[model samples]
Target: MTHRFVGVGALTDVPRVAVVIDVMRAFTVAAWAFSRGAERIVLASSEEEALALKAASPGWLALKDGPPAAGFDAVNSPGLMRSADLAGRTVVQKTTAGTVGALAVADAPLVLCASFVVAGATARFLRAEGREPVTFVVTGEDGRADEDLACAEYIGRRITDSDVEAGPYLRRARTSKAAGELADGVRRGYRGVDPDDVELCLEADRFDFVMAARREESLLVLRPLPRAAVDDGGEERRTARR
Candidate 1:
């Protein structure tokens, strides 16, 4: 297996497995929702599609960041998802970077979504599968999305170098420009923004499951690949606990 890291602009060039990283809360929210027992998440490339999906499914919830769209059930906040009772419910998510990036590479043989929260599990999944020509998609603008890049690099390192410490990467993510923007937004009382969400996003390997995406009809659906499928003798879990 080969690993390559690239920005969102290179998403179309991905050949096989693609892991999309959106550390500034998109994939972080998804990870929290899955941990809270969400059945599956449908990633929409646009707000309209997300609302439509929610409307079609009676109990499904629609979530996104930014100013509220009329039909969205809630803002895409990791803190809110952490406390949400999402048991057995499907979610429709549309985001600026993460979800969009995943869907853009939906044609790949396998697509996984990651943030700091699921970094280790994702790496374990990749190593277990041994898929060739894997690409890590940083879902931020090239050179401007430090948080996403940090997560991508961290995942790559975790897969190729067992002794790589997550400390430096997590620090980079916490002090990144995206984190600073979130801090400023929370300070100004920006809607759908919270400092606790940033704290949640920065927690490395918070989940032991991988969020894998599949294209179903017109939607890209994400569900957790449980620990049983990704673990290499529980090493990832043990390291995460430490």
Candidate 2:
């Protein structure tokens, strides 16, 4: 099986398995939190739900969605996740693009969550397993350019067996003014974050876990690939160029 990339709205030709990216904040923060040992992530489609879940859970960390503007919880900053103790903790996250996009594909045969930081790992996992007809869904923010597309391009390169290059998508993402603005915002508020985290998210094929999204009761949960299923395999790898 081969993989193709498409924007969020163009999901009419949904595949059996899909990987969604909204790296700017949602999934990036989720991935970082997981790396920090977060037990699970509850993705709230709205702020109200996220807060409610947090209130109900007492100790669960909460994040609100805000884009084109600041979110209720200081926007999506990796630094914020780093500073907190998320080990074995649960996070309720709401994001403009990430959570909404994941829900849009809830009916997909298989939905995997992804971010820039784990693009390489996602590609390698898909290749090793040979999952076919995979769709790299870029959850765009209000139809504008964002980190989702960039992360898609990075993953597209890794899983595709074709000769097509992901250079154009990667180049566009690197030069996007929006990305620059977001980076600047982060730099201004938190000086310790390496500008390379931004750059690293743009790199192709970096990690090994393919995040999986599933609904647990009413909340959408995302977490790393289970340890037992890491070696599964089946088809040819393909990139979604456009």
Candidate 3:
């Protein structure tokens, strides 16, 4: 199987099987949301659309980061997601990088969201499905999303059955430009931004299911793939959904 890494700007060139990486909290928040039993996540391409979707659905929750969008339920913080009572609730998510990247490649036949939290499971799912010629969309604008690039590399290594020790990648992510900005934002009391978000986003393999994206009316719906695990012989197995 061939694997290529591309930036968000390489939109028109995205292929049939693609994994979008947003390690500095977008996909990380998404992983946490799924872990907390959120029914599903509707990804909005923009803040306005996210707000409109949440407004239209009375019980839906709106999540994003940076400056507050009026009427947003919460900022896209993994800490908040971990503690949220999201059982059977839907989340409308808009983010600068993660959601935008996923929507940009929505036409791909197999589009999965990725971050450190679900990297292993994503790789396992891809391997089990025999997906070929995969493209990793780094999502961060330009080539500066170091954390995301690191996660992509980690996932690539996992897919290739290579030495997948995560120390180097995690260290790189912890010290990346995005991580520093996140720290500063927390210190400055950015609303809905949490001080622990960095560490939360770095928890590799925190969940054992892949986040698959499917197109819905005016939104991309994200749901966790059924639980996947590797057997002793390194073969993939599907287990009952958790």
Candidate whose lDDT is highest? 1
The total of clashing pairs for model 3 equals: 0
Q: Number of backbone collisions per candidate, in order? A: 0, 12, 0
Residue-wise lDDT of candidate 3 within 1-242, one digit each (tens)? 68888888876765778899999888999888888889889999788888888889889999887756678877788877788888999999988888888888887877889999998888777776676788999987564688999999888888878457988999999999989988998899887778799999889888888888877665688887656343221322322111
Q: How far does residue 126 in candidate 1 sit from its true spot (Å)? A: 1.0
Top-TM-score candidate index? 1
- CA lDDT, every model vs. true structure: 0.83, 0.66, 0.82
Worst 10 contiguous positions by lDDT, candidate 2:
233-242
Q: Give RMSD (Å) of candidate 3 vs. truth.
A: 3.6
Once fitted onto the true fold, the runs of candidate 3 whose alpha carbons sit more than 4 angstroms away are 67-69, 228-242
Q: List ranges where model 2 is wrong by over 4 Å.
A: 66-75, 141-146, 161-171, 186-197, 203-207, 226-228, 232-242
Question: What digit string (tens of lDDT, one per residue) describes model 2 on residues 88-170?
Answer: 88887887787888888876766778876676667667666565778877776543565576666667666764354556666
Candidate 3 lDDT trough over 10 residues, lowest sum: 233-242
Error of 1 at 5 (Å): 1.7
Q: By TM-score, highest first, what's the ranking?
A: 1, 3, 2
